[model samples]
Target: MMGGRGEGVGCVGGVGGRRVGVRGLGGVFEDKCKEGENEPYRGALAPALALALAPALANTHHHNIIKLSLQGNVGHLVQQHAICHGNLDYKLEDGQGPVLMTTVAMPVFSTKNETRNRGILLGVVGTDVPVSELLKTIPKYKLGIHGYAFAITNNGYILTHPDLRPLYGDGKKRRKPNYSSVDLSEVEWEDKDDTLRNAMVNRKTGTFSMEVKKSVDKGKRVLVLHNDYYYTDIKGTPFSLGVALSRGHGKFFFRGNVTVEEGLHDLEHPDVALADEWTYCNTDEHPEHRYLSQIEAIKLYLSGHEPHLQCDKELIQEVLFDAVVTAPLEAYWTSLVLNKSENSDKGVEIAYLGTRTGLSRINLFVVPDELTNQDFLTAEDKEGVFNADHFPLWYKRAAEQVPGTFVYSLPFNTGSENKSVVLASTAIQLLDERKSPIAAAVGIQMKLEFFQKKFWTASRQCAALDGKCSISCDDENINCYLIDNNGFVLVAEDYTLTGKFFGEAEGAVMSKLLQMGSFKRVTLYDYQALCWVFSESSDSGHTLLDPYFAFFSAVKWILTELVIFLVEFNLYSWWYSDLTAKGYNKGKRRKRMRKEDG
Candidate 1:
């Protein structure tokens, strides 16, 4: 029943509601705050407005947009409702007339993965605000104010204009008639009527002149003017706003009421040949935020799609911080290769690690600049950047010393500024049947100071040589090799075998000098290295070996040889029969039995 309500918009009415405060031109400087998760207040506010205006209302929303993604359709709906609701309460008749309201609706994809063919409707009803306030409400993009602004609908209806009335009002009997949502592109502005089309094409910020409908003089036909406008496509929601200010006053003045059909209509020079320089602008002089494109990127990213547009480095950083640190772990991360500048050579490498709880983690990956390549690094260049002495052993070491994290340390090297650094954090695994790692960790290039300060590193203290003993391992003798549980060598005497099981190491025989203590042999368990206890230690190359394991292996070898000997000698059946023969357990010898004997 909200259809064609603009037709009866002539009468004036007063409705007692909260007086809305216009932020004015200054509001254009304020940054937009992040909206609440997925929910648009206007979806509910519109109905409340309808109840106050038309008490017999059945619905506040003609269609629901909750099915749309939390980023796009939902966000735009919230923005429109906010802009309308915060303006004023408008009515048609004084004190007791039907309340005037502006309804906004757009089709948005249900979720990130769904296509546009399945877009859901997001709609909101708001009290109609005066045109004056609407014209002054420009978005703040960290750029200065635009020269002027205008509002339009999806079908190209002129919602609000600054210095003009209805494009073609019936008469002065109506100051402004409610066209509800009229197609202003059908009318003329500047020299022609192509403003809306051009605006849509310049989805971001561009300079274009449209045929001005409803000029201030109401009689100017060819009054063409140039302006710079910022376009905002309300993210996820289906709406756009064009805000701009005039670039120049004019080259000449024409009669305010004269319509220029073809030839010049200026009274001073009716047949004057005009040049395009007076109103030509190829590009924006001070390009800034293009709202429409930004919203598209937002919607695309939220709906599980990669945004095609080049992400702003600052914006990209902010988004990553929010997703990896601030947002709940349920909001998984997406990767981005951010370019610091369009002309810059190197790009930032980014990755994400998700978790069950949204607890923020610090750097989990630290690639020492000197050690991140095919070339070898000296001890000083490598430092604790890796665990081992050789480059390959570093790879064998885990990125983190512990199961869930890395040893975080901040290097004092001033030269780290030119180096590429990445911070990685643990992430939760995905629930797919593959049971593969859904997410391992989140990482970002070490550019932003915010990333650099949260850096993590691990360090260790050097132990004295008193408890250490020399042992020959794998023909490469080592003073002391780190060993693990079950008498397996870890940091083998031979550096090449660090990652392989210590039991597989060659020449790992115990040394006689190390046979002094009950637990002189050292090993590691749960990642901690320690000296293990032995029954006794002796000189002459005596090693502390677990006797039970030796016994178990010997038994296994004997059983294997016995089976082979019986099979090779063709006595397998005789051996089996003898072993299972009834007389064996009964303590009595049995005569050969025939198949017929039951």
Candidate 2:
């Protein structure tokens, strides 16, 4: 008969074939003999029997060498096993000499029975892996010599790192170290703030930057290098993976590492250098493929920079010839403005033009020296330069216009002067080159108040012509407004209504004005009756009408009338029903009295 094993450890020894049957009760076994021959086999328990008793003896609190080891109740060999909550443990020994391995344990259970839905707690079954074998599975960097990957456990322990030894011990004795005892920061020296270790322990995924000192020029010099790290947890496990890269050698290295080629590059070529600086807003910074910010681009433009029109030799020559021809036109424009507006104080504040030489644009800005010295512009704008690309709306409108024909922009406020101005644009088409169709344009920024004054003077002239058509600039009875073709108010007595759509100002009269296309005068009798409300501001003679308020007022009136009608209808129905019931009751009473008298 085989004996009991020691400490639930398996015994590995060849045994002769024999049919053995034994009865056991309270940790004692009895074997029956045949014909007065009785002896107990006290060597070691069979491997199968030892495995069967493992689950029962796993949690027992007893020191029975008979139940532990079967060699005459004397326990010799002991097995060392670790048990911790939510932790993967390594074993020192498992009955078969020192194995030095880790295990993944799964709870083994008996099949379900009639009394219980789930099986009984039999024991734990575990799969063992040698530490040496597990070392081979640890990952390594596949690309870039400077970058490396590492792994750590949930308890801030180092599972794998570049500097950490994967397999521990000398060749004679294979030993596994307690990996959970080693902290990750012990190997990662660059983790000065301990951020990486904390993030890994907390199971967080993010990136951080750190600095490391490294030997340079074969240990002749040492330099501090910036490093970036990205870390995340390994799913289905308690470990995390961390990847690190040297900051200067990773992605976006081209931002500073690349050198300019020594050739006629667009930004480097003599003809295109000025143009490139002027049109830098359109050019993307290499590697990133993004243009400079508007604030930065505008600053570069206003510093007297000019574009070379993409180094087009023909286009450059044409623009140069045009500039020569238009040089005197600037003086002529200035003279005409001074000659015409000498009697009146108001005139053009600034006159600038953007010429489309090729695909790019160049601004030929002309602001009088006296006006430029004023605090009309913001501090930054006054300090920096201007680019035609910065004001695309003003430039593109003129560039796309028909040649020599003028188009006007809605009046907009300009500068610290608090004066409103309108932009008048006219395109200048090329005459000599039919193949290269270039459309240059000029813009004259005139004060909006100047136009208001002109209209006011015309009204006075009309009053002088006819007695019935008398009107004043501040007349409350008359409201004057000039609208664009799209019915957006451009000029109004109230400057606040300048940029508003016509429909928003007068919804009731909007259809009438839209239908009367180019008619000079069309009067509506009792015009105030069409509108519900007007602004109460007394400074402006003709206040802006609020159509939204009128629409809501009309809706409120309709709802009030509907509620009154419903209430009156309900009251009339009740009154009619009560009167009919009273008449029927009076008739019944008269018939009862006649029956009683009869």
Candidate 3:
């Protein structure tokens, strides 16, 4: 939880002055000011206490702050101001030993033309934002019911996580680690491959899934569940935001019978109104939302075993009925459909009504245009005729499921251009007056690129409130995907691989990738190999050893060489002495022999 000081923004004055002042719309630090008995400071009440400013603060540069403020669309202040930012740190209060905070300062610099304080440092306006406040809203935003959010720094250190324990030292020495030292890998026990950690630290935006084991019934039983993760780096900051969802709890799709017991409470609301009460929908207002019955829908509803509708009017009416009934979904559709990509031409390419008869049916589909051209769809008043063969094959597969269940389709081609697309459909069982079931389903189709971008942008949006920073997800190293149970690529940054087997693209077994298992092994192997190669090389800069170890190694080599040289020199001296003695003896013996012969 954030302290009161962090809830609202404030300004701190007098960085280089003898006294500092704090002010804000919320009257920040007003109580402390009132308690002071000293003379008034900054033309207001004096602060309760005076503290010494650090000498290092005098030489700080603030150019990044200006750039961030501009990107964040920050409004101008009444007065001119300069900017400065600080790293995460701990501030010890009178009673509190230490509290972590991030300080950002906006300074008022002396003008170049000023006569008295020309080009000199002036007072600074800063705020102490507790780290808790910086990340307070993260947990509230989740991927699904069992989803959660976590953050990490550029170095892979955990910033905020559900399982994080900030305190480390024991007893009187107990204190928070320097700016969250815990690594993300510590709590993500199932992440064996280090894929999530590496990708996030490297500032890539993507999604992936893993399996997690949980104990239930007081550890009597264990359950293996799939966990999905979406992550992206915050722009202009050293942090990344991630959201994880449990497979069972997240409503990726609905399965089994759609019952009244399963709440559609929003639909029951009186405020839930239709686009057009008389006609199911008006193509003029929402042309993309209303499509003429696809040949697939007509075949299923009109020519199927039950033969529910006899004529084209009946089929068209069914389309209108489905469209009007699904009005509650407009808000969601609008957000997704209207969202355009960085490339203006690309967006949610297609949104259509795919109706079929039975107790279970897929009612609507929002997809990218197969032709990859969204503008062509509305350029002319085209006839409402769909190619008889163009209905998605996945639609039929989805229609086979019981109402209230969700279905995910493999990648397929649409339109003559053969662009690949994926669909996710949810089935709804509509009830008649006597409680008989009529089928209804809502589905969406997205281009691989559009789908990937949508989720990546979602992760980057986490830094929206921090006006001084922006998020970037366009790194070439970015590789993330939405995968299914069997490791099939669903949505991926690499759009070409959409709908392919994950193993096929990655060339690894599913078990190896279970929890980034293979990735971890690869990283370890690379590390060891590099260590071995660099160990044999003579490059001191690239050597793994620290300066201390290098110094000791040099000393050891010199000593070894000195010992060998001394032993060799001693042996040579001994050999020369022995040879000289032998030569003198031989000469004396030859002289004695010559005298005896004379």
Candidate 4:
């Protein structure tokens, strides 16, 4: 029996009715009895028993008695025995020897919708070309069907070429056959109160609905529902306005034939004005058929003073290029007036040019001359300066180059630098090269190291405090995992956290977890965490446990050390440490002197 103090007894053979009990062997064991008794045994059963069980006991106790001298010598034999028969638990533990726990409640798991809600915007650029022409160009450019494009406008009206026009023809060719209009009795319904059932019951018979549906289907893109009256209803009657609306229901509603002079009057009281007299009307109902005149469309196109030409390949390119050069100013001005009217003190001015996949934005920042020259590039092209202490004036100058443009400004405190520009430019060289605006914007705000550290630390803290640390990989293409305070993973087997966008996805996940109100702090594991976790696993070949646990523990230790180093160096603070400390010390001395004088 294996017990405390390693003491046990085994039976020895008796000689001729007399029993002999042996104590310590010291390399000698003998059974002695009377001379007349049977021949005394040469070897004692106790010694044999000890010899047989010693090897097994040594193998079992080798792990616990690693520091023992004899045990060290039996390392190879013990290891061999363990490999052949022993099962071990090799889970890693913290320095304090506590079992590492992970919580699924960490702030890093979220749905796509929730991620978008946290200031993620998806933008698409559109063109006026017919679906057929667009489709032809799509493959040539190697562009996604759901992407950006320069609008083709002739005299401010979207140009439609003959090739493109073929895509938009008579209602019969454009619309799908409405089998939805079949009798309700012939159709199957799983639920009586289903919205689809209701839609079938109220089947719309208007040609406009068919035309709109056909356009949408041809576009082959998901249409986000906009509640704006211009895009939805005309006097409460549904009418499709083919334009993308901004987040706040704002859109560019072009009136084809009406002049600016006539537009102002129509906008004031649109109900009384004839449709031909107005450029665009904000109404909840579709205009009457007789009111849709060709002249109105023509005037609206001409109002912007844009050149008109018969739609052709050359003409299309010319119009598109012109729109690209001029659209930025138009977009900027529209944003400004809307923001002012809304009484928003903090507004962002944006000038957008190009299409969805090749878009660029010019952000204007207004700053004083002194700070501006140091921080941002000047339009004057000052040499030898690589950095700016404040936003330069060049962005405002860029804004001024176009008409009706304005800058977005927020209220500022006295003596503070008022504005900063963030110019987000995407490589328009090709469709595939379009950078994600969301990613670019976030990239500017914080360093990748800072983000990674914050995420990993937060995750570890959450796991330590909570029993379960929940982690999910949004980008399945990449391998990502959350490490516990001891660096073990809570994820299932066959999953790994690796790849380029893993950190960003982890950040997004963390944001969602925060919203769900599960865990307060969440951190994303980075390469540093990976290194720590992996190195420890490689070192410990004796312990038998999940390799993930060893890694998790190492990551936790690494993060903990990083946090300590940052705190010790005062690196977490934004201020220049040496200068701030010096200034603070001076102030303290002055205060002490004044107190002594008093």
Query: Backbone collision count in every prediction?
Result: 45, 9, 11, 54
| C-alpha TM-scores of all predictions | 0.22, 0.30, 0.28, 0.17
- Give per-residue CA lDDT, model 2, range 1-598, as digits (tens): 0111101111000012111111111221211211211122222112122222222222221122123333222222111111111233345555533433433333333444451344454554434444333332221111123445565655665654544432332322343343434567655555768988988676565677787543211111233457677665443234456666556433311001111221112222111212222322332334222454422343343333534211223333333433444445556555766674552554455555444432222221334453432332222231112221122344434433345667666432222342655667666654432211324456665566765676677766765576756557568877877765335566777677775656667766775754665322221111001112567666543323767777888899999999999999999998887554333588889999999999
Which sections of candidate 4 miss by over 4 Å? 1-202, 205-598
**What digit string (tens of lDDT, one per residue) describes model 4 on residues 407-505?**
221111111222322322221212122221111110011112233444456645655677655653433565555422111222211223311122233
Please tell me which predicted candidate would have the highest TM-score against the true structure.
Answer: 2
Measured over all alpha carbons after superposition, the RMSD of each candidate to the real structure, in angstroms, is 33.1, 34.3, 27.4, 41.6
Ranking by lDDT: 3, 2, 1, 4
Error of 3 at 123 (Å): 7.8
Q: What is the lDDT of residue 313 in candidate 2?
A: 31
lDDT of 4 at 91: 25
Of the pair 1 and 4, which is ahead by TM-score? 1
Q: What is candidate 3's CA lDDT for residue 499?
A: 60
Candidate 2 Cα outliers beyond 4 Å, as residue runs: 1-310, 334-344, 358-391, 399-404, 411-418, 430-438, 459-476, 515-598
lDDT of 1 by residue, 336-405 (tens): 1222343133333333222211112222122335223212222333221211111111111221123444
Q: Tell me the whole-model lDDT of each prediction, alpha carbons only.
A: 0.30, 0.41, 0.43, 0.26
- State how far residue 60 of model 1 sits from its true place (Å): 17
Error of 3 at 209 (Å): 2.0
